[model samples]
Target: MKALIVDDEQPVIVSVKLLVDWKKYGIDTILETTSAADVPALIRTEKPELVISDVQMPGLSGLQLIAMIHEIHPPAQIIMISGYSKYDYMRSALQQKCIDYILKPLDEDQLNAAVGKAIETYRVEASQALIEQSYDFLHSELSKKRAQRLFLLYHTSHQTSVIWAQLCEIMPAFSSMESCRIGILPTGHLPSELFSGARDLSLIVNFIHDLCYETGQSIASEEPIDRNIHILFHSELSNIPELCRRIVDAVREEFHLFLPLGLSPAAPFPVNFSDAVRQAEDAVQTCGLMYTRQPVCFSHVTGKEAETPPVFRMEEQLYTAVLNGHPSGIRIAVRLCLSDLTSGKGLTLRQLLLFRTAYIGLRMRWIESFRMNHKTAASLDAPPGSYFRLPFRDDGQYDLSVMEESLIADLSAISDYLKGVLGMGPASQNLFQQIEQYIHFHYAKHLSLESIAEEFSLSSNYLSRSFKKKTGSGITDYINNVRIQKAKELLENPEIKIFHIAAQVGYSDEKYFSRVFKKTVGMSPLQYRIAHTAILPPLDLM
Candidate 1:
């Protein structure tokens, strides 16, 4: 480690240098510079692990120099030296993460202690960093191998023996294991409420590792693929079904939550890994659709026609009600449709989303037809890929109840938006009236379509359409009308100049105000004032 000492004053620098034993503190070289200006360049070249500087300098104060050095070398430890013993300076030094703040007229013992402390701290941190880096490299290599094993299993052009070689290196028991299988935790299998907002799979992975380690049933390696946890199991002693049952029981015991596990029929290693993965996925899909917590193995399930009887069929009443833009019956229709879909034995998220897309599309069209703000209306338009933006659990499981509730909310919003447009419903009408009243009162102030809409907490497009429908005039026209009416009252005064009258209203330009005056009132300000001014019948002196 290297240490750099910066001070404009020579005596203080020399005194400090003589006091500390740099070699004893593990500092191989001690670089001394009298100029604060040269500190940045030296920091780059020397790359010192420690910087000791005087707080008050000619060009750059110690605080400024420390900041500049930090930009060049963030990990370098800094110690502040100053003539002043003020608390503010000490507080500032602490805030900058300086290792030590030393006072001038320095103590030799204190200086040596601070130097020794900084060196020791760097040594410990460096050692710890090296250890962590090594661990991370190992974990990363293992994770890469796990991913490669899955890829080779699924894409299968590579020789299966190569995969076996890779697996055997990481997992010793896999060398003799005859069969293997992959299982997926399909969406909605685990209740979202259990994990809540956690997005990291580490907790669940750790639990699985602990369970497998304790039982000594099989060597389980977990890889998160497409937001689903796929656990690879290898065994020399235990059967696949027994292993699956142990996993499910362990989860239930730990979380007090039901976890539906699906296992592919164990296939002989290497050659049948791909088929096993597919089988496991299908089994998981079936378990998810049935909403069962038990482990469902493809090999164990026989007579599929008997276990899962088809229960879903489209109902015309719900479809027609949705088409007619009646939300009153949409809720019941949505519930019935969801129930029918979930009733089947094997339903996947993709299938469910595709079926719901048509109904949501119809609702979007219904919403688009209403006079709504462009932003809100655009939100109603579902992105080409997604149905709607809804929250899901950490494990990527969809909460059917939340999904259904969102659909209901969308239906209600569509109904409300339509009603407001057709009948100028009281709630919607009141908003328009409020906007108009705001314009009436603030006509003399600067106003624009966007600004007024913001004032009323509305979008410009929606407010403009609604205002035109209710008042029979556009927003700009209404503002000008209010200003013109006020201008006429001012014109009655006869003392205020036309330019002053224009300024009294919102218009700054007299020419523009006159053009508007003529356009609305059919006369110039001067002409209208003369025409309206009363003339007394010739004062009768006779």
Candidate 2:
């Protein structure tokens, strides 16, 4: 694609330029220098695929330049030009692997033919190099996948010695290391569909490798377990926080995503690797719930495991309200319980999540009591344990306002269900209308069948069957339809990006949103926007 010409005479360089249409030979850029000494430096920097040189120059001769070219860029195709027809020069040129030898007082046809031959040779070498590189890359990837599987097995299996031996066969460095620390880089709240494609996963793996290498750390092994990438590090524990910070910053700058890293304390190599892996996993779980932006360590969480009485007292008040069948009392109790959990000093997000889990267990016991006492009331199906799982922001941090609102809504729904069974609440038709209104209001938030059912104190099966029977649509379909409708309205504004619209409509993954939009509107989001709006400048799908 590029050619460099070296000659002592400026006129000779100009003649070569005018002799033939270099563009016809696929040489778009033509560089020239009168000094032979400058050729090697140019080759190193510019890396031109084709080289044309005069045999004799002021400083370094063409044969010497050819030797330097071979040492510097061996792939460069060379054509040697000489004024005299010297047999020794031709022999040396051939030894240096020059593609062609042209004589001075250059003939146009001969020069054109030589340039075409050089271009063809360059293409062939480049194609061959690409094939070899691809083969190497595939072999390297295959080895990495095998190592990842061994790592998973070693961490999970009781026989660590056997797996470590197998791992050292591929990664010999592990045999030399005495100890290592494990770190988990969680994808946080990013949708799993973002990594459903191998290209995306490979990009992430390469990006992480580059950043870690820059920080003077090499990943011994990296395995994707659940939503986190478990990385083995031979670096010191003190160096880990800074390395993690760099990795987090780089990922944020490059991928535009927040990646939280969690580290475990140093553990002895091979034997304690499983414990290290588990500690790293625990650290990530804590980091997922914490409000801080820094990386978390398993030790830090263990150091703050003190008891809090306020959470317990507030939970008791909530339990008492449910037992008394007081709907208003339940609302007040839910508020106070959440407020107490959040207001306490040094209370981590993990504590709040734990308290919620305990509260759900107690609530289930209360429901059983009601069933035993009110035998004449309609049969009440208990919601699944998963229905009460806390909702977190896309960044893997809790939003207290959203959490409080959701808790109130679901607990209030339970009160309504209990009252309805006792003939003290609204009719089924009115309740369904209220549910529809609630969905319309909170459509932008994370809404799921289980959470919605939990909010109304009704069983998931009961709500799913009843709602479809009345509205002729499933809850999930209704939710997606509502989101697509909002997305269409947002798409009309050309200023907003499609991904932003996806977030605004409660879809975290843009690609997933596009598919849903196409399924609902009979066209992709961009196509729909183009059809409805005036022509506008292009914007990224992300």
What are the RMSD figures for all models against the true structure?
29.3, 22.5
Candidate no. 1 TM-score: 0.40
Error of model 1, residue 236, in angstroms:
4.1
| Top-lDDT candidate index | 2
In candidate 1, list every pair of residues with a backbone clash.
none
Cα lDDT tens digits, model 2, 1-542, are: 78999999999999999997887887899999987767778999999999998988887877888888889998899998888898888988888788888898899999988888888989999999999999998977676666667766766576378887887776776667688888887652344555545426557766776554333334533454554666777744346777777777766666655556778888887678778878876776554345355544554443343365344577546544543445677678877876666563445545655666566666675555445435655355543232343445544445666666666666666665555654434444456655664566567889999988887779999999999998899999999998898899989998888889999999999899899889989999999989999876386755
Query: Largest TM-score belongs to which candidate?
Result: 2
Q: What shift in Å separates residue 379 of candidate 1 from its native position after superposition?
A: 11
What's each prediction's TM-score? 0.40, 0.65
What is the lDDT, from 0 to 100, of the residue 312 in candidate 1? Answer: 21
